[model samples]
Target: MGSNGSDPPRPVVGITAYGEHARYGVWDNESVLLPRTYPDVVIAAGGVPVLLPPVPESAAAVDRLDAVVLAGGPDVGPDRYGAAPHPRTGAPRPDRDGAELAVLHRALERGIPVLGVCRGAQILNVALGGTLVQHVPDVVGHSGHNPSPGVFGTVEVALEPGSRVGAALGPVATVRCHHHQALDRLADGLVVTGRAADGLVEAVERSGAPWVVGVQWHPEEVATDVRLMTALVRAAAQNRTTAP
Candidate 1:
Protein backbone atom coordinates (compact mmCIF):
# COMPACT_ATOMS: atom_id res chain seq x y z
CA MET A 1 0.00 0.00 0.00
CA GLY A 2 2.60 2.52 -1.05
CA SER A 3 1.50 6.06 -1.62
CA ASN A 4 0.51 6.85 -5.19
CA GLY A 5 2.11 10.31 -4.86
CA SER A 6 -1.21 11.73 -3.67
CA ASP A 7 -1.61 11.68 0.08
CA PRO A 8 0.54 13.71 2.47
CA PRO A 9 3.57 12.09 4.06
CA ARG A 10 3.14 10.69 7.55
CA PRO A 11 4.32 13.04 10.29
CA VAL A 12 7.50 12.10 12.11
CA VAL A 13 6.88 11.92 15.86
CA GLY A 14 9.83 11.79 18.27
CA ILE A 15 9.13 9.94 21.53
CA THR A 16 11.54 10.14 24.46
CA ALA A 17 12.94 6.87 25.80
CA TYR A 18 14.23 5.80 29.20
CA GLY A 19 17.85 4.85 29.76
CA GLU A 20 17.86 1.97 32.23
CA HIS A 21 19.78 -1.18 33.01
CA ALA A 22 17.91 -4.27 31.92
CA ARG A 23 18.36 -8.01 31.54
CA TYR A 24 17.54 -9.25 28.09
CA GLY A 25 18.51 -12.57 26.47
CA VAL A 26 21.01 -13.48 29.21
CA TRP A 27 22.73 -10.14 29.00
CA ASP A 28 22.39 -7.42 31.58
CA ASN A 29 23.23 -4.02 30.19
CA GLU A 30 22.21 -0.38 30.07
CA SER A 31 19.80 0.37 27.24
CA VAL A 32 17.43 2.94 25.91
CA LEU A 33 13.90 1.69 26.42
CA LEU A 34 10.33 2.68 25.63
CA PRO A 35 7.17 0.62 25.67
CA ARG A 36 5.88 -0.72 22.36
CA THR A 37 2.54 0.91 23.08
CA TYR A 38 3.92 4.39 22.43
CA PRO A 39 5.10 3.71 18.91
CA ASP A 40 2.13 1.45 18.24
CA VAL A 41 -0.31 4.25 19.06
CA VAL A 42 1.66 6.71 16.96
CA ILE A 43 1.57 4.39 13.95
CA ALA A 44 -2.12 3.71 14.40
CA ALA A 45 -2.64 7.46 14.36
CA GLY A 46 -0.87 7.76 10.97
CA GLY A 47 2.51 9.02 12.20
CA VAL A 48 6.01 7.61 12.09
CA PRO A 49 7.58 7.14 15.52
CA VAL A 50 11.23 7.79 16.38
CA LEU A 51 12.71 7.08 19.80
CA LEU A 52 14.77 9.90 21.32
CA PRO A 53 17.22 8.66 23.91
CA PRO A 54 18.28 10.83 26.84
CA VAL A 55 21.23 12.71 25.41
CA PRO A 56 22.17 16.35 25.82
CA GLU A 57 22.11 16.81 22.06
CA SER A 58 18.73 15.14 21.57
CA ALA A 59 17.03 18.52 21.57
CA ALA A 60 18.64 19.30 18.21
CA ALA A 61 16.57 16.54 16.66
CA VAL A 62 13.35 18.44 17.35
CA ASP A 63 13.94 20.64 14.31
CA ARG A 64 13.72 17.52 12.15
CA LEU A 65 10.50 16.27 13.73
CA ASP A 66 6.94 17.38 13.18
CA ALA A 67 5.91 16.59 16.75
CA VAL A 68 7.19 15.16 20.03
CA VAL A 69 5.87 12.92 22.82
CA LEU A 70 7.37 12.84 26.31
CA ALA A 71 6.73 9.29 27.53
CA GLY A 72 6.16 8.28 31.15
CA GLY A 73 9.13 7.50 33.41
CA PRO A 74 10.46 7.97 36.98
CA ASP A 75 9.71 10.96 39.16
CA VAL A 76 11.41 14.24 38.25
CA GLY A 77 13.96 15.57 40.76
CA PRO A 78 12.62 18.02 43.32
CA ASP A 79 15.72 20.18 42.95
CA ARG A 80 14.41 21.09 39.51
CA TYR A 81 11.81 23.24 41.28
CA GLY A 82 13.77 24.16 44.43
CA ALA A 83 12.02 21.63 46.67
CA ALA A 84 13.55 19.02 48.95
CA PRO A 85 13.02 15.43 47.83
CA HIS A 86 10.14 13.76 49.56
CA PRO A 87 10.70 10.45 51.32
CA ARG A 88 8.58 8.69 48.69
CA THR A 89 10.11 10.45 45.70
CA GLY A 90 12.12 8.35 43.31
CA ALA A 91 15.78 9.07 42.64
CA PRO A 92 16.51 11.53 39.86
CA ARG A 93 17.75 10.61 36.42
CA PRO A 94 19.78 13.68 35.53
CA ASP A 95 20.46 12.58 31.97
CA ARG A 96 16.79 12.05 31.28
CA ASP A 97 15.68 15.20 33.03
CA GLY A 98 18.19 17.44 31.29
CA ALA A 99 17.65 15.89 27.88
CA GLU A 100 13.86 16.05 28.10
CA LEU A 101 13.91 19.62 29.33
CA ALA A 102 16.12 20.57 26.42
CA VAL A 103 13.91 18.79 23.93
CA LEU A 104 10.75 20.36 25.36
CA HIS A 105 12.20 23.89 25.26
CA ARG A 106 13.37 23.38 21.71
CA ALA A 107 10.05 21.98 20.55
CA LEU A 108 8.15 24.88 22.09
CA GLU A 109 10.42 27.36 20.35
CA ARG A 110 9.76 25.61 17.05
CA GLY A 111 6.04 25.53 17.66
CA ILE A 112 6.06 21.77 17.31
CA PRO A 113 3.09 19.79 18.53
CA VAL A 114 3.98 18.04 21.79
CA LEU A 115 2.18 15.43 23.90
CA GLY A 116 3.33 14.57 27.41
CA VAL A 117 2.18 11.38 29.10
CA CYS A 118 2.53 10.76 32.85
CA ARG A 119 6.05 11.86 33.78
CA GLY A 120 6.24 13.53 30.42
CA ALA A 121 3.55 15.89 31.65
CA GLN A 122 5.54 16.58 34.78
CA ILE A 123 8.64 17.34 32.73
CA LEU A 124 6.72 19.92 30.78
CA ASN A 125 5.64 21.61 33.98
CA VAL A 126 9.06 21.61 35.64
CA ALA A 127 10.70 22.88 32.46
CA LEU A 128 8.39 25.85 32.64
CA GLY A 129 9.12 26.81 36.29
CA GLY A 130 6.29 24.78 37.81
CA THR A 131 6.50 22.39 40.74
CA LEU A 132 5.11 18.92 41.39
CA VAL A 133 3.15 17.59 44.36
CA GLN A 134 5.95 15.02 44.94
CA HIS A 135 3.60 12.48 46.51
CA VAL A 136 -0.07 12.39 45.55
CA PRO A 137 -1.21 10.15 48.42
CA ASP A 138 0.22 12.59 50.92
CA VAL A 139 -2.14 15.27 49.76
CA VAL A 140 -5.01 13.26 48.26
CA GLY A 141 -5.09 10.85 51.22
CA HIS A 142 -5.47 7.83 48.96
CA SER A 143 -3.46 5.56 46.70
CA GLY A 144 -6.18 5.05 44.11
CA HIS A 145 -4.12 6.84 41.44
CA ASN A 146 -1.42 4.21 41.77
CA PRO A 147 -2.81 1.12 43.38
CA SER A 148 0.31 -1.01 43.12
CA PRO A 149 3.39 -1.76 41.10
CA GLY A 150 2.79 -2.70 37.45
CA VAL A 151 -0.90 -2.01 37.76
CA PHE A 152 -2.75 0.94 36.28
CA GLY A 153 -5.65 2.41 38.21
CA THR A 154 -8.76 3.79 36.57
CA VAL A 155 -9.52 7.50 37.12
CA GLU A 156 -12.37 9.60 35.91
CA VAL A 157 -11.16 13.02 34.76
CA ALA A 158 -13.39 15.97 34.06
CA LEU A 159 -12.24 17.90 31.04
CA GLU A 160 -12.46 21.64 30.64
CA PRO A 161 -15.03 22.37 27.97
CA GLY A 162 -13.64 23.89 24.75
CA SER A 163 -10.13 22.78 25.64
CA ARG A 164 -7.89 20.97 23.15
CA VAL A 165 -7.89 17.93 25.42
CA GLY A 166 -11.63 18.07 25.77
CA ALA A 167 -11.97 18.22 22.00
CA ALA A 168 -10.05 14.97 21.73
CA LEU A 169 -11.27 13.17 24.85
CA GLY A 170 -14.65 14.82 25.31
CA PRO A 171 -16.09 16.28 28.51
CA VAL A 172 -15.22 13.42 30.80
CA ALA A 173 -13.00 10.39 30.35
CA THR A 174 -12.18 7.26 32.29
CA VAL A 175 -8.40 7.16 31.95
CA ARG A 176 -5.67 4.68 32.88
CA CYS A 177 -3.53 6.31 35.57
CA HIS A 178 -0.37 5.11 37.32
CA HIS A 179 1.32 8.06 38.93
CA HIS A 180 2.25 9.17 42.47
CA GLN A 181 2.91 12.80 41.59
CA ALA A 182 0.99 15.50 39.79
CA LEU A 183 1.17 19.18 38.90
CA ASP A 184 1.11 21.57 41.87
CA ARG A 185 1.78 25.07 40.51
CA LEU A 186 1.11 25.43 36.80
CA ALA A 187 3.57 27.41 34.71
CA ASP A 188 2.81 30.53 32.80
CA GLY A 189 1.18 30.12 29.38
CA LEU A 190 -0.22 26.76 30.50
CA VAL A 191 -3.64 26.01 31.91
CA VAL A 192 -5.25 23.06 33.62
CA THR A 193 -7.57 21.29 31.23
CA GLY A 194 -8.57 18.23 33.22
CA ARG A 195 -8.83 17.08 36.80
CA ALA A 196 -9.79 14.02 38.82
CA ALA A 197 -12.76 14.09 41.19
CA ASP A 198 -10.31 14.70 44.03
CA GLY A 199 -9.19 17.94 42.29
CA LEU A 200 -5.81 16.62 41.28
CA VAL A 201 -4.54 18.04 38.04
CA GLU A 202 -4.84 15.43 35.33
CA ALA A 203 -4.17 17.42 32.16
CA VAL A 204 -2.62 20.70 31.00
CA GLU A 205 -2.17 22.55 27.72
CA ARG A 206 -0.60 25.71 26.42
CA SER A 207 -2.95 28.67 26.34
CA GLY A 208 -2.06 29.62 22.80
CA ALA A 209 -0.84 27.77 19.71
CA PRO A 210 1.52 24.91 18.75
CA TRP A 211 -0.68 22.21 20.31
CA VAL A 212 1.07 21.30 23.56
CA VAL A 213 -0.92 18.89 25.76
CA GLY A 214 0.06 16.77 28.75
CA VAL A 215 -1.91 14.09 30.56
CA GLN A 216 -1.29 12.54 33.96
CA TRP A 217 -2.52 9.19 32.65
CA HIS A 218 -0.93 6.98 30.03
CA PRO A 219 -3.16 7.22 27.00
CA GLU A 220 -1.09 4.57 25.21
CA GLU A 221 -2.04 2.06 27.91
CA VAL A 222 -5.58 2.05 26.58
CA ALA A 223 -5.58 0.40 23.17
CA THR A 224 -9.24 1.09 22.57
CA ASP A 225 -8.81 4.88 22.72
CA VAL A 226 -6.71 6.46 20.00
CA ARG A 227 -8.36 9.86 20.07
CA LEU A 228 -5.54 11.67 21.90
CA MET A 229 -2.85 10.24 19.59
CA THR A 230 -5.02 10.96 16.58
CA ALA A 231 -5.34 14.56 17.65
CA LEU A 232 -1.56 14.90 17.96
CA VAL A 233 -1.00 13.31 14.56
CA ARG A 234 -3.50 15.61 12.92
CA ALA A 235 -1.78 18.64 14.47
CA ALA A 236 1.56 17.37 13.25
CA ALA A 237 0.22 16.96 9.76
CA GLN A 238 -0.99 20.51 9.79
CA ASN A 239 2.39 21.70 11.07
CA ARG A 240 4.19 19.85 8.29
CA THR A 241 2.02 21.43 5.63
CA THR A 242 2.21 24.93 7.03
CA ALA A 243 5.85 25.16 8.01
CA PRO A 244 7.68 27.88 6.11
Candidate 2:
Protein backbone atom coordinates (compact mmCIF):
# COMPACT_ATOMS: atom_id res chain seq x y z
CA MET A 1 0.00 0.00 0.00
CA GLY A 2 1.20 3.48 -0.79
CA SER A 3 1.62 5.94 2.01
CA ASN A 4 -1.00 8.66 1.63
CA GLY A 5 0.18 10.67 4.64
CA SER A 6 -2.56 8.92 6.65
CA ASP A 7 -0.94 5.51 6.48
CA PRO A 8 2.41 4.42 7.80
CA PRO A 9 5.23 3.94 5.34
CA ARG A 10 6.32 0.37 4.72
CA PRO A 11 9.92 -0.29 5.60
CA VAL A 12 12.21 -0.81 2.62
CA VAL A 13 15.42 -2.79 3.00
CA GLY A 14 18.17 -2.53 0.40
CA ILE A 15 20.01 -5.85 -0.02
CA THR A 16 23.35 -5.93 -1.84
CA ALA A 17 23.84 -8.45 -4.69
CA TYR A 18 27.00 -10.31 -5.70
CA GLY A 19 29.07 -10.55 -8.87
CA GLU A 20 30.05 -13.92 -10.31
CA HIS A 21 32.39 -15.63 -12.78
CA ALA A 22 33.29 -19.04 -14.30
CA ARG A 23 36.64 -19.18 -12.61
CA TYR A 24 39.15 -16.97 -10.75
CA GLY A 25 41.43 -17.04 -13.80
CA VAL A 26 38.73 -16.07 -16.30
CA TRP A 27 36.61 -13.24 -14.93
CA ASP A 28 33.13 -13.47 -16.50
CA ASN A 29 32.87 -9.71 -15.97
CA GLU A 30 29.10 -10.02 -15.98
CA SER A 31 26.87 -8.79 -13.18
CA VAL A 32 25.57 -11.81 -11.32
CA LEU A 33 22.09 -11.13 -9.94
CA LEU A 34 21.46 -13.43 -7.01
CA PRO A 35 18.80 -13.17 -4.34
CA ARG A 36 19.93 -13.10 -0.76
CA THR A 37 17.97 -15.33 1.58
CA TYR A 38 17.87 -12.51 4.11
CA PRO A 39 15.36 -10.53 2.10
CA ASP A 40 12.95 -13.42 2.36
CA VAL A 41 13.75 -13.45 6.05
CA VAL A 42 12.88 -9.76 6.14
CA ILE A 43 9.65 -10.40 4.27
CA ALA A 44 8.70 -13.11 6.70
CA ALA A 45 9.30 -10.57 9.44
CA GLY A 46 7.06 -8.00 7.68
CA GLY A 47 9.32 -5.71 5.67
CA VAL A 48 9.82 -4.91 2.00
CA PRO A 49 12.90 -6.06 0.14
CA VAL A 50 14.50 -3.63 -2.28
CA LEU A 51 17.40 -5.34 -4.04
CA LEU A 52 20.04 -2.62 -4.00
CA PRO A 53 21.92 -3.30 -7.23
CA PRO A 54 25.50 -2.26 -7.75
CA VAL A 55 25.29 1.42 -8.49
CA PRO A 56 28.10 3.85 -9.17
CA GLU A 57 26.58 6.24 -6.68
CA SER A 58 25.67 4.91 -3.24
CA ALA A 59 23.98 7.97 -1.87
CA ALA A 60 21.21 7.67 -4.42
CA ALA A 61 20.66 3.99 -3.59
CA VAL A 62 20.60 4.58 0.15
CA ASP A 63 18.17 7.49 -0.19
CA ARG A 64 15.42 5.20 -1.52
CA LEU A 65 15.40 2.82 1.41
CA ASP A 66 14.61 3.22 5.08
CA ALA A 67 17.07 0.49 6.05
CA VAL A 68 19.95 -1.44 4.43
CA VAL A 69 21.38 -4.91 4.63
CA LEU A 70 24.91 -5.89 3.55
CA ALA A 71 24.43 -9.50 2.48
CA GLY A 72 27.11 -12.21 2.52
CA GLY A 73 29.27 -12.62 -0.58
CA PRO A 74 32.89 -12.68 -1.79
CA ASP A 75 35.62 -11.63 0.63
CA VAL A 76 36.23 -7.93 0.87
CA GLY A 77 39.38 -6.51 -0.66
CA PRO A 78 42.29 -6.74 1.80
CA ASP A 79 43.43 -3.21 1.01
CA ARG A 80 39.98 -1.88 2.00
CA TYR A 81 40.42 -2.67 5.69
CA GLY A 82 44.18 -1.98 5.76
CA ALA A 83 45.52 -5.48 5.29
CA ALA A 84 47.28 -7.54 2.66
CA PRO A 85 45.56 -10.36 0.79
CA HIS A 86 45.64 -13.79 2.32
CA PRO A 87 45.64 -17.08 0.43
CA ARG A 88 42.08 -17.66 1.60
CA THR A 89 40.73 -14.22 0.74
CA GLY A 90 38.56 -14.48 -2.36
CA ALA A 91 39.17 -12.23 -5.31
CA PRO A 92 37.43 -8.90 -4.69
CA ARG A 93 34.48 -7.75 -6.82
CA PRO A 94 35.16 -4.11 -7.51
CA ASP A 95 31.56 -3.33 -8.53
CA ARG A 96 30.09 -4.78 -5.35
CA ASP A 97 32.87 -3.15 -3.36
CA GLY A 98 32.04 0.30 -4.68
CA ALA A 99 28.26 -0.10 -4.33
CA GLU A 100 28.20 -1.49 -0.79
CA LEU A 101 30.76 0.98 0.54
CA ALA A 102 28.69 3.81 -0.88
CA VAL A 103 25.48 2.49 0.59
CA LEU A 104 27.07 1.78 3.97
CA HIS A 105 28.52 5.28 4.23
CA ARG A 106 25.24 6.91 3.23
CA ALA A 107 23.19 4.63 5.49
CA LEU A 108 25.35 5.52 8.47
CA GLU A 109 24.95 9.20 7.80
CA ARG A 110 21.19 8.77 7.34
CA GLY A 111 20.65 6.79 10.54
CA ILE A 112 19.27 3.79 8.70
CA PRO A 113 19.05 0.40 10.30
CA VAL A 114 21.93 -1.56 8.75
CA LEU A 115 22.42 -5.30 9.25
CA GLY A 116 25.61 -6.86 8.03
CA VAL A 117 26.02 -10.62 7.58
CA CYS A 118 29.30 -12.42 6.94
CA ARG A 119 30.98 -10.50 4.16
CA GLY A 120 28.45 -7.79 4.88
CA ALA A 121 29.82 -7.57 8.40
CA GLN A 122 33.31 -7.04 7.07
CA ILE A 123 32.03 -4.33 4.74
CA LEU A 124 30.38 -2.57 7.65
CA ASN A 125 33.60 -2.68 9.62
CA VAL A 126 35.72 -1.41 6.73
CA ALA A 127 33.27 1.40 5.94
CA LEU A 128 33.48 2.50 9.55
CA GLY A 129 37.30 2.56 9.69
CA GLY A 130 37.75 -0.93 11.08
CA THR A 131 39.71 -4.02 10.04
CA LEU A 132 39.24 -7.79 9.62
CA VAL A 133 41.11 -11.09 9.98
CA GLN A 134 41.61 -12.15 6.38
CA HIS A 135 41.59 -15.86 7.13
CA VAL A 136 40.36 -17.23 10.46
CA PRO A 137 42.14 -20.56 10.12
CA ASP A 138 45.40 -18.86 9.22
CA VAL A 139 45.27 -16.28 12.02
CA VAL A 140 43.51 -18.26 14.75
CA GLY A 141 44.81 -21.63 13.61
CA HIS A 142 41.44 -23.16 14.29
CA SER A 143 38.60 -24.67 12.29
CA GLY A 144 35.79 -24.08 14.79
CA HIS A 145 34.78 -20.82 13.16
CA ASN A 146 34.21 -22.35 9.75
CA PRO A 147 34.53 -26.09 9.53
CA SER A 148 33.65 -26.47 5.84
CA PRO A 149 33.66 -24.03 3.01
CA GLY A 150 30.05 -23.01 2.10
CA VAL A 151 28.73 -25.19 4.89
CA PHE A 152 27.20 -24.13 8.18
CA GLY A 153 29.01 -24.79 11.42
CA THR A 154 27.32 -24.65 14.80
CA VAL A 155 28.92 -22.36 17.38
CA GLU A 156 27.85 -20.84 20.65
CA VAL A 157 28.14 -17.10 21.04
CA ALA A 158 28.26 -15.39 24.43
CA LEU A 159 26.52 -12.10 24.26
CA GLU A 160 27.65 -9.08 26.23
CA PRO A 161 25.07 -7.92 28.74
CA GLY A 162 23.07 -4.80 27.82
CA SER A 163 23.81 -5.06 24.10
CA ARG A 164 20.92 -4.65 21.66
CA VAL A 165 21.77 -7.95 19.98
CA GLY A 166 22.09 -9.55 23.37
CA ALA A 167 18.72 -8.25 24.41
CA ALA A 168 17.08 -9.24 21.13
CA LEU A 169 18.70 -12.68 20.98
CA GLY A 170 18.58 -13.20 24.74
CA PRO A 171 21.68 -13.66 26.93
CA VAL A 172 23.18 -16.04 24.37
CA ALA A 173 22.43 -17.86 21.14
CA THR A 174 23.90 -20.53 18.90
CA VAL A 175 24.21 -19.10 15.41
CA ARG A 176 25.38 -20.70 12.16
CA CYS A 177 28.70 -19.70 10.65
CA HIS A 178 29.88 -19.95 7.02
CA HIS A 179 32.68 -17.43 6.57
CA HIS A 180 36.41 -17.50 7.34
CA GLN A 181 36.77 -13.75 7.86
CA ALA A 182 36.02 -12.26 11.27
CA LEU A 183 35.99 -8.91 12.95
CA ASP A 184 39.40 -7.76 14.17
CA ARG A 185 39.85 -4.06 15.07
CA LEU A 186 36.34 -2.89 15.83
CA ALA A 187 35.08 0.29 14.25
CA ASP A 188 34.40 3.33 16.46
CA GLY A 189 31.09 3.16 18.33
CA LEU A 190 30.72 -0.48 17.35
CA VAL A 191 30.72 -2.70 20.42
CA VAL A 192 31.37 -6.40 20.16
CA THR A 193 28.24 -8.15 21.37
CA GLY A 194 28.89 -11.80 20.54
CA ARG A 195 31.96 -14.03 20.33
CA ALA A 196 32.74 -17.58 19.32
CA ALA A 197 34.26 -20.22 21.57
CA ASP A 198 37.62 -19.51 19.92
CA GLY A 199 37.42 -15.84 21.02
CA LEU A 200 36.72 -14.56 17.51
CA VAL A 201 34.29 -11.66 17.36
CA GLU A 202 30.92 -12.79 16.00
CA ALA A 203 28.70 -9.78 16.36
CA VAL A 204 28.95 -5.97 16.65
CA GLU A 205 26.43 -3.14 17.10
CA ARG A 206 26.49 0.63 17.22
CA SER A 207 26.70 2.03 20.73
CA GLY A 208 23.99 4.66 20.30
CA ALA A 209 22.09 3.93 17.14
CA PRO A 210 18.65 2.40 17.28
CA TRP A 211 19.79 -0.28 14.86
CA VAL A 212 23.21 -0.94 13.37
CA VAL A 213 24.32 -4.52 13.87
CA GLY A 214 26.61 -6.95 12.06
CA VAL A 215 26.92 -10.68 12.50
CA GLN A 216 29.48 -13.10 11.16
CA TRP A 217 26.84 -15.78 10.65
CA HIS A 218 24.11 -16.84 8.26
CA PRO A 219 20.84 -16.17 10.05
CA GLU A 220 18.94 -16.19 6.80
CA GLU A 221 20.01 -19.72 6.05
CA VAL A 222 17.74 -20.74 8.91
CA ALA A 223 14.17 -19.61 8.48
CA THR A 224 13.49 -20.53 12.09
CA ASP A 225 15.84 -17.81 13.26
CA VAL A 226 13.30 -15.05 13.64
CA ARG A 227 14.82 -12.75 16.22
CA LEU A 228 17.59 -11.47 13.98
CA MET A 229 15.33 -10.61 11.06
CA THR A 230 12.52 -9.48 13.31
CA ALA A 231 14.72 -7.01 15.10
CA LEU A 232 15.97 -5.70 11.76
CA VAL A 233 12.49 -5.35 10.20
CA ARG A 234 11.07 -3.82 13.35
CA ALA A 235 13.78 -1.18 13.36
CA ALA A 236 13.28 -0.59 9.64
CA ALA A 237 9.52 -0.28 10.07
CA GLN A 238 9.98 2.26 12.83
CA ASN A 239 12.54 4.18 10.83
CA ARG A 240 10.28 4.39 7.83
CA THR A 241 7.34 5.64 9.86
CA THR A 242 9.44 8.32 11.49
CA ALA A 243 11.46 9.29 8.45
CA PRO A 244 11.34 13.06 7.98
lDDT of each: 0.94, 0.82
Across 47-80, the per-residue lDDT of candidate 1 in tens digits comes to 8999999998899999899999999999998989
TM-scores for all candidates: the values are: 0.98, 0.89
Residues 165-213 of candidate 2 have per-residue lDDT tens digits of 8888888888888888888898887888888777889899888765999
Question: Weakest 10 consecutive residues, lDDT, candidate 2?
Answer: 20-29
- Please list the residue runs of candidate 2 whose C-alpha ends up more than 4 Å from where it truly belongs after superposition: 1-7, 22-29
What residue pairs are clashing in model 2?
A: none
> What are the clash counts of all predictions, listed in order?
0, 0
